[model samples]
Target chain A: MRPKIYLFGDSITEASFDDGGWGASLAHHFSRSVDVVLRGYSGYNTRWALHVLERVFPAVDSGGEGVGDGVVPLAVTVFFGANDACLPDRCSAFQHVPLHEYKQNLLAIVSFLKKRWPTTLVLLITPPPIDEEGRLQYPYVENPLGLPERTNEAAGAYAGACVAVAGECGIPVVDLWTKMQQFPNWEKAYLRDGLHLTQIGNKIVFEEVVTSLREKGLSLEILPVDLPLISEIDPNDPLKDFQK
Target chain B: MRPKIYLFGDSITEASFDDGGWGASLAHHFSRSVDVVLRGYSGYNTRWALHVLERVFPAVDSGGEGVGDGVVPLAVTVFFGANDACLPDRCSAFQHVPLHEYKQNLLAIVSFLKKRWPTTLVLLITPPPIDEEGRLQYPYVENPLGLPERTNEAAGAYAGACVAVAGECGIPVVDLWTKMQQFPNWEKAYLRDGLHLTQIGNKIVFEEVVTSLREKGLSLEILPVDLPLISEIDPNDPLKDFQK
Candidate 1:
């Protein structure tokens, strides 16, 4: 079976296959090497994601006869906290989880995945810095009160919590919140509408994710291509190359 | 488990997850609904592809206890014939298969898939129209003799055979050969390297595939989204909606 990489997150990850999405870039980068599987759920907070964890990655039988839920993934990225950071008093409060609960939920997720695929690499990605002005201009839904449902400050708290959880778990973390802020005019450059990523923003996430995997010895340079390259096949004895 | 759509073909299909690939578009289109799996073999022709088919789609046990190789896909696309269309007397002769063999191989593939997944929607895609001039300009390998390894005429034959095979099997076939030539400046517009696709070419394939699937009762409109939409969840009791 091909080694698989799972992207588990919310809307940000869910829309990662769009024209220039980070997920699509990952799929392209890992083409013929690792299969990238998206398990993103739009509008999901860490609390809601935690509720669906087991169903998404169900436990296999002790004997492993059934090979339940397909193969164990090589790595899984937990990229929630976007919706979790929504302002509790705003229109998007329904998707909000308390700051403390968000961190705890992420911890639970990492633990569950570790138990399921003991050796699988676990990576966490903090929510990107929000653009309050952009959010006001492009709300996902009708904002009758005309207030942004999320703020960069509120999202930073979730991002910090995500980093803290990653540190506690001894795994890698991609602090998108901090990374995006490092760029000048990031409000319009990295984000398309204050929350979701722009193409360039997607590229950054893709690079960060790849770098994280590379540091752990999963670089494309080392990963074997699935089949022999066309140039490798001898014209006279082609079948010989297809031998198992 | 999410429904899967498998793309089985040669290099053109292999590179379908590239920056502006049809496979990426498909994945984006089917987001939150079906999973698109790529099983493309670069530099592989029908003969070579047939040799590896069984291994790629291994048979499951009668009782189906293990889901031997995961869930059955909802649809599978058999896209080949590009490399097979290479001119027999040219440098790419090594990858060539006789026209008759190409048709027979496709028939066998369709038979095998139907037996394995009786209800699975099977779609065939013909090789796109080639540009002999473009082939010489952007040769994949060194061409000291300054000769094109593939020809538009040969590709048309292979595409015709592909369509015939699909007709014999009673499955839908994307006549990319004919469809591409219908464009006024197709030589440069559709094909990037005479053989592979340009962004617009990929978009065309994406649309054709979606249309074919739609005709067979698999349109995105009818396919239920995997989970509850955020709007559908009651803010007062979100968990109540996730009970399933």
Candidate 2:
């Protein structure tokens, strides 16, 4: 009866199971214990995610709200705002939400889930910094407006705002935007296209996410010891020790 | 909430998450959809497994009993008998449960699980036939006894008995014993040491497990279309179609 960890966010979280996605890394790391559920909605921001959360999660109390029907998660990583950070004038009009509202929406979402799963640990992940040069050329995510759609500076603002909201809400925050920039020429080294994570980018996020999790004391080191080490059990009449 | 599927077996199931294990294949294949719980206890046979079942699984009617705390799984794979097929006269006495008891133990395990999770699909996997020639060479599992630990003949008999029990229980069976032999020189190609699955063997089990699950109409195709496909959703407001 391992506890569940929900990865809730955008395309980054959704692609966690990709060839070398962070989700796969976590899955491999937490092999036999801790079910990692992916609830990432690609191309979704805080606004769209808020609309879809009820549908995605079952209600803790069915009270007609039809959400939170699933088992209570042990932890949830709410990683969003990449799409919300889309420059309103430059990017798709449909995806943009005012930065103030974006922060409020995140707080509301976190509060809602925390109310349902009081024991669940919440980790907020700010989207990685955008890459303007990569956006102008190569296989970047298509922007309908023909404009760059987002600049590293703008997305980084949303990332900072995300960390602020997480701080106010008293939850762990993985500031990938700031973290990825630590390396020189991080745009190509970390991100694949302008936005989505490459294998290396995924690794950076994975390390940061794991580091934050360890800081919160919900570390991976506690995983292996959680399951029954059957080989260590007494060979003959092992049922004695097998008893709870 | 994604329902769980338990990979219940010995070392084979235990190592299912190992780099190229079939369990990982299933996890990767059904990412974000099914919870593949690993309940593999190494070096344990059907006899020990039967003893540990109540502890490993939740008791249906806890009525005073403190078990049955976990979520009801969608399915369970009862794969055992590799060690049970050990020669009683020549191998480690503790592991060698006679073939007759092995069949009964499988039935008891199934009946117990069915009683708790009546709706859960049960898939019994017959152990891969032991490769004596391979076991004697290079790096096979150590056999403390001078005589070979298991014989293909004995394992095949248990496999036959397993299919028979499954037929009686109206459950599915993955007959690796017979299936592996279908390939020429399967010893080295399929069996890494002699008993456990090789990389190719894991693929074989993964395919068979998936095939049987599909036969039961629980294929991965049934995964819910949860996220909003930006292209599919109306550009203006797509929340209407987002409803179940």
Candidate 3:
């Protein structure tokens, strides 16, 4: 059974495999090694995520020996809060969830994964910092929402909430919110819009994710060396390795 | 359960999910409705594929009564012939397969999938035309192979064979070989190297793949309307839709 890396999140998570996407980088880096399952839900926040998470990732239903007991994935990345951090009681009113509820929802997700798919590693990524000024200059994809529907400060707060939850849950977290800002001229540099990641932003997350997963034993150096190379096997008996 | 579309092929297939990839395009187009599984094996020809195919996509073993009989995917795109059509008499002899054998391998793949995964539609994509001029300018990824290990004529022949096989099997085929060349200035515009696709090439494949799948009844217009929306469910009873 091939290993799978599940990416769960909102639009940023949704667009993780876009052109020059972080998810694409991961897929390329781990080509022939792992399957990167895209579970990105566009326009979703913690509240909606909480409701749909179970269907997307059902628990091991029957422990007493059943097909549902397929091997747990190698890792699951929960990347929410981008939409959740949209200023509650502000424009684009539908997607926003209060900061406290976002924290609680994240905790529930991490805790559920821990209890159900115990073997898989869970990593949380805080929403990247938003650019209110930059956003006002550009029309975000969710065009109906007014400019500055989300603010860096508000997103930063949710990012902090994410960190607190990750800290309490003992999970690895890629603080895109903080890391993206560490670079020079982050406002115009990292974000594609005030919301999504640019190529640079995606690469940062990709590198951090690979590094984090490697630390958790999913090494980048460990290519699928175990699989039989074509030339290594007799051309006439190609199926031998597979059959065994 | 989400419907899945499987992409199976060689290095080109392997890189299909890369940034701005056709695979990513498919994923984006089918977002929230379907999952696109990347089953790309690099430097592999149809002969190697024949042997390893079952392992990657095993037949529904003991369908009589078993959980292993999970839902078959909506479609599977078998894209080979790039490496298979390697000029056997010319350079880098490792990946070369005789024309007759190449045809046989294609037949075997289709027949096997038709019988094994009966429910899933299998679409065959002829490898894109090779650009000898571009290839000479740029050393192809398979560097051991000569500057022109493959040729447009050679690839086209295999593509014809592929079309013939598809016709005989009565299955859908994406004649990329014929379709790509239909445009003027095809080579410099589409192919990055003689063997692989550039951004334009990738987009063409993405569009063709989507169009063909839709023609086979998997329409792009259809959203996953069957699944319950978050708003439809009570926030306190998140698992309601999932359990049902």
Candidate 4:
């Protein structure tokens, strides 16, 4: 039985089930060695995700007789905090939890999971950037202020904060913000609103993860890629615009 | 124009708006030196309040308009993090941010306000406890592994985390949790849901804030009470149960 790779996050991960999300690409890319489980919610933040894990994960009851066989150790990747940034009223019903709190929340999850699965490797992925137009055309970027005037800088700070927290917790980080920024015309590569990624963007992120894993000495034989060839398609054909 | 002391928080502060909430009582208690602005929202957390401040405060723009005259040095007392503890799935869309994130979010607000009003004294209040059986009749407790367990410990932890963060930020904390825990029957003191405060709880929190202010050397003469008799009302009277 293949080990499971749990994709836990907000819309970015949840969007994987759709035609152009990274989850689909990731699943295809690592089909043989891992079973992918998407536990993404559209408009969730770190605080809420921690609650979900606290309530739902424990209920899964991975005991062989209860949940089923092939329920061994799993790799969990957490991506959250975008929607949390856009809350209308910071202290109203929702908290635009400061970056520090976001880090602590992530740490709590890592700490909790580490206790449960001592050897489980947890990966933290910083959410991608929201384009200048300020729409989170993805599932949820509620920032009423629109993207911060200094969005790249703000996004970088947020991602750096995530990396710092992950480093403090000894967890690995996949810096999606930097990787996405490297793309030429990233805004164009994004969907209309620029919060969610275009297919090319998702593919790039997926490849980054694969590259990171390979660099870490992890075997790729276990994770398989069964998706149709991307190379056969024209690179810039107007009809090839998958985002449309 | 009297100097304004804005009292912002969740239900405990919101209740003051009604005959039962301590806001009115506190207003009466400190009417001389301060003009208390009760901006309280029920079912709110630090996240939402920060959002509100971001939106509302920016409109109060402290720039060249000569506008924020009376509000320039406004003092704020923030009491929140109760509804945040009752999240069905902490990560769900229903609001209830996780504890750690809640703290960071609160700190962000503090930082933002401090930048706006460097001399403005901000008070951080950890809300009191809710008796699960009395006010909170729902499945407020977590039933991990099918074993029912009270989440009061988690709630307490959330409060403690808030205190820690506040302490780190050098903000004053009104320790409502410690004081409220001393009550004999906290559940009965609360309204039906065990989440919000009873009239008694609100009063106690209100007194604590007043006492904290006096301790800070703020003069009470400028803000004299209009109604001094309300505090003398018996907390045990059934007819006086303000939680309803």
Task: Give each model a TM-score.
Answer: 0.96, 0.80, 0.89, 0.42
lDDT of 1: 0.87
- Could you arrange the candidates by lDDT from highest to lowest? 1, 3, 2, 4
Off by over 4 Å in 4: A1-244, B59-70, B88-93, B135-150, B190-192, B221-244
**B1-244, model 3: which lDDT tens digit per residue?**
6677889998788888787889878887776688787888876889878877767775445462211335577889999998888776555456788889999999999988787667779999998898898877776334553557778999899999999999999999999999999999899888887778888889999999988988888875764642454456444454464566
CAPRI-style class, candidate 2: acceptable
DockQ of 2: 0.28
Could you give candidate 3's per-residue lDDT for residues A1-244 as a string of tens digits? 5678889988787778778889888887887788788888766788778877767776445572211325577889999998888765565656788988999999999987877677789999999988887777775435554557888999999999999998998889999899988888888778877778888888999999999999888975764642565546554454565565
- How many clashes does each candidate structure show, in the order listed? 0, 9, 2, 47
Candidate 3 A-chain TM? Answer: 0.88
Candidate 3: RMSD over Cα atoms? Answer: 3.6
Q: Kindly list the per-residue Cα lDDT of model 2 for residues B1-244, writing each as its tens digit.
A: 5567888898888777664578767866776577577777777788778877766775535362322433567789988988788777763555688888998998899998887777889999998988987666643345666567678999999999999999999999999999999999899899887877887898899999999999997786875545657666665775564664
Decreasing DockQ order of the candidates: 1, 3, 2, 4
Higher-scoring candidate on TM-score, 1 or 2: 1
Per-residue CA lDDT of model 1 for A1-244, tens digit only, reads: 6778888888899899888889989988888888888788889998888888866666565554222455778899999998998988898888999999998899999998887778889999999999999999888877888999999999999999999999999999999999999999999999999889999999999999999999988888998787777778998889898896
lDDT of 1 by residue, B97-135 (tens): 999999999899898888878889889999999999999
- lDDT of candidate 4 over A1-244, digit per residue (tens): 3356666777676665444456645544443345455566555567656655653344233342211222444577778766555433421214245677777888898887777676666788887876756453432324454334224455666788888878898768888887777768887785446567777777776776666656554556544422212233232341232222
- Candidate 1 is graded, for docking, as medium
Model 2 has an lDDT value of: 0.78
lDDT of model number 3: 0.80
**Which is superior by DockQ, 1 or 3?**
1
In model 1, the Cα lDDT at residue A99 comes to 96
